[model samples]
Target chain A: MNLQVELEHHRRVLIVRLRGELDHHTAEAVRTKMDEAIQRGRAEHLVLSLEDLTFMDSSGLGVILGRYKVIKSLGGKMVVCHVNPSVHRLFELSGLFKILAIYENERTALSELEVVS
Target chain B: MSEKLEQISDHDGNFMTLQFASRSENEAFARVAVAAFVTQLDPTMDELTDLKTVVSEAVTNCIIHGYDNDPNGVVTITARIEEEIVTITIEDKGNGIEDLELAKQPLYTSKPELERSGMGFTIMENFMDEFEVVSNLGSGTHIRMKKRIESKKALYN
Candidate 1:
């Protein structure tokens, strides 16, 4: 499975639009790319746009949890938006929804981050 | 809900077994192959995703904790389909789990340094209708999962 990561620079956040499957094969790349984007952007928050994310497993959960720790340690927040039902169920089962903010769309996430910022 | 549904409803009974080296790459292949085979059951998107995730977790365990990342070890997956039900068995001949209870606990990973989420078994239990795990210290681990795909006809009612 190939993961296509598109990083968009916002004023106080990095908007990460991920496409394709996020399994063991592509988790490492997503982690690397997201870390780089967060560091390079020097942003205070992260908005993960998962509208196009097709699939995700526990490996994907581990990566997301690891990044949540990273952004948390940095005192930045992370929000996931446009999650499909399948991936959303993964988030629910992994107990990620308790820690990560979920939004319906990118605009909602950006606006929520604006308030936090 | 997809084109794959028609192809599966026509088949009566299908069974297949796949065994390969306990390599990380083989995990992806195991998932795709089993998922492809299961399409014959006309599973919904959610069902297919759940099945694939379960396959990946089981195979990954075989490669990592089962064989300790040994490329020489082997992982075998057997899938059987009857009507709307699919049964998948993942087997590995490697050092097995020492504590079955601890292994099943959520967020309990023997190797935390590897950043394992420890949600593999949890996901499998939740996704499939029936889940079973058998392991011994030196023998190996076997995971059997069964799920019944609900057809649209059943949903309309």
Candidate 2:
């Protein structure tokens, strides 16, 4: 369960790039890290970059949804980018695509967040 | 579902059963082992990924839902490869699901505090060709899933 969470504070948006597998064993760490970052950095929007995410299960969906809720409650928008086919399917199945905006890369996601914020 | 499981037992195929403590860490090991086991059939990358995801889902359910994250509980996985088909059955001897139907619904997590997506069963069913769950109230849950792998060997021939 190797997952790397790299966060970059771009203006008022936080660009989070995740690499490796995200599952039940590793989701907690990500949730904690993102929660802390969101609160501490006071991000106005979030850009989740999953370009290097090799695998994700329902647990991954839960963590992403949890963060989405956190950002939503704070009056911030959260967008996801670089989702692989399999992870994309999970997002579609869970209906997260309907609520969250998706982009092709971190730059686009950040730019979109910038416009909205 | 039991009859289908019996059919697999009666057939001649490569099979392996793994028994381990219901620890969260074992979730990775369980899915990887199953993926490795089915490698002999040479599943496609998508097929392999689907199998790995379902295994993770079932094993996670055993640890979280069945065993309640009790590391002391035992989780068993039996996987068999017959021809181009792979069958995996995950079992646990812990608190069984009280309402199996409700448990299968999407976004219906019993433990919302844990942030469970409640998409485990749905993923398992959609990813595999066939999926079934049989569990008793006091007993544990048994998840049996079967997928027909379009092996490269068959594709070329």
Candidate 3:
């Protein structure tokens, strides 16, 4: 279960790519990684690319919701992209889509969060 | 000698039992065990999805709530098929649920800090035809669920 997060910064926008299962065992690691990226990257916008994620439980929801809260407090926006069917159902049930913006793909999400510069 | 976890014949019903550690890895094993056991039946996609969801909920409850994250705890899963019905039982020796009714309530969780939705019982109930939870305060918890196998006649026509 490898969780890889890549940070692509375009001025104030940050795109994070996640791959792998996000469950109780791995949610903490994901939280830590994302937090580090936000602090070090100084990103004002965050886009989560979940195209390669295979599985996720409620624990995964916690991570996303937690990040949403963090970004909101920092006056930044959060977006999710490329959710598979299984994980998509979870997002729908949890009502995360209502709180966080969901894009069809990472490219679109990133474009939507285009920095002024 | 009767083993704690024994495979039973389908004459009474196609049933198999598995004993696993109360760890995250065991949840993966539970899913594989269910897939293998139900493969002979040739279930449809919907049926497979229901079975997987139910099994995942049961195993998760055993590990998170039943075992209280105790790695040394043990979880026993048994699956039996009688006629057109499939029955699965998951038992764990941990701090048993104090109130079965409250525990069954949707979105009710004892460990909210862990971000548990407390929808395990709700999901199990929705996926399975019948769901039952039996527990003692300090003894253990036993979750038994059943689903009727959809006949081909119902699927094709």
Candidate 4:
């Protein structure tokens, strides 16, 4: 019912690990929490690890898309890693993969973003 | 509407009904609770996930679009697994959709300002083997979905 958010910083890249349900119920809180983290001036890029994400729906997609816009507006990059196949299908259905890269793990995502973790 | 979970079973199949307020938190409850019930069927992880996703989308539509985010509204969820097939119905007594066709269109949301992706119906359609939407403007909305979960035997042979 509650999403546990863990923040990791690698230089300017912020890795957010989300564990729990990411539906409409928790999307607003996530946006607020991550938005605050992003505004802290420590992040030039963002990476999300959803390895433990138990569930997600369109509202979750909206939150991700919303964050992508914020990062794009700042000329920074956003990538999502460790997406379960069910969630990955949503990214494909919503055409998010075309804009945001989906990586197998945090290591691959950091490597692709050219940020050393 | 009573908020208690009631069980009613017959020869057709055993069914449980859950009635709760139209609150965002219930969206999580709807999926996880139903997933827990469906666990007895021995559904694959993907099958269970699919059911939960559709349940979330349907309940969300009822809460946001049907009830207009009003906490007083009620949403009723009935889930029954008879044999290998599961049937679920989510209903709300709130303002319903005016245009079913437009509403089901991918990426078409009545409230884009709310950051709605409008993929709720689409996901429901894709996840469930059978999806049906019944709504009337100024009335309410009812969604019925069913899927024949792949049993372990089917996967092996």
Ranking by DockQ: 2, 4, 1, 3
Cα lDDT tens digits, model 4, A18-104, are 998999988888998899999997998999999999888999988898889988898899999998889989988878889988899
DockQ pick, better of 1 and 3 = 1
The digit string of per-residue lDDT tens for model 2 on B18-134 reads 889999888889999999999989888999999999999999999999988889999989999888888899998889999989999989999999999999999998999999999
TM-score of the A chain in model 4: 0.94
Which 10 residues in a row give candidate 4 chain B its minimum summed lDDT? B1-10
Global CA lDDT of candidate 1, please?
A: 0.86
Return the top candidate by lDDT: 2
Backbone clashes counted, model 4: 0
- Model 2 in CAPRI terms: which quality? high
Model 4 residue runs over 4 Å out of place are A115-117, B1-11, B152-157
Q: Which residue window of length 10 is worst by lDDT in model 4 chain A?
A: A108-117
lDDT of each: 0.86, 0.91, 0.77, 0.89
Give candidate 2 regions above 4 Å deviation: B1-10
* DockQ, all models: 0.59, 0.83, 0.33, 0.75
- The regions of model 3 sitting more than 4 angstroms off are A2-7, A115-117, B1-11, B149-157
Q: Across residues B1-157, which tens digit of lDDT does each residue of candidate 4 receive?
A: 2333332453377677888999998888889899998888889999988998999999999989999899999999998878788999999989999999999999899998888888999999988999999998888999999999888548667
Tens-place lDDT per residue, model 1, B9-51, is 4567877778899877777788999999987666787778889
DockQ of candidate 3, scored on C-alphas against the true complex (2 decimals): 0.33
How much native contact recovery, as a fraction, does model 3 achieve? 0.13
Candidate 3 Cα deviation (angstroms), residue B3: 6.4
Order of quality (lDDT):
2, 4, 1, 3
Write model 3 residue lDDT over B96-148, tens digit each, in one string: 99988998887678888876766677768876899898999888999998888
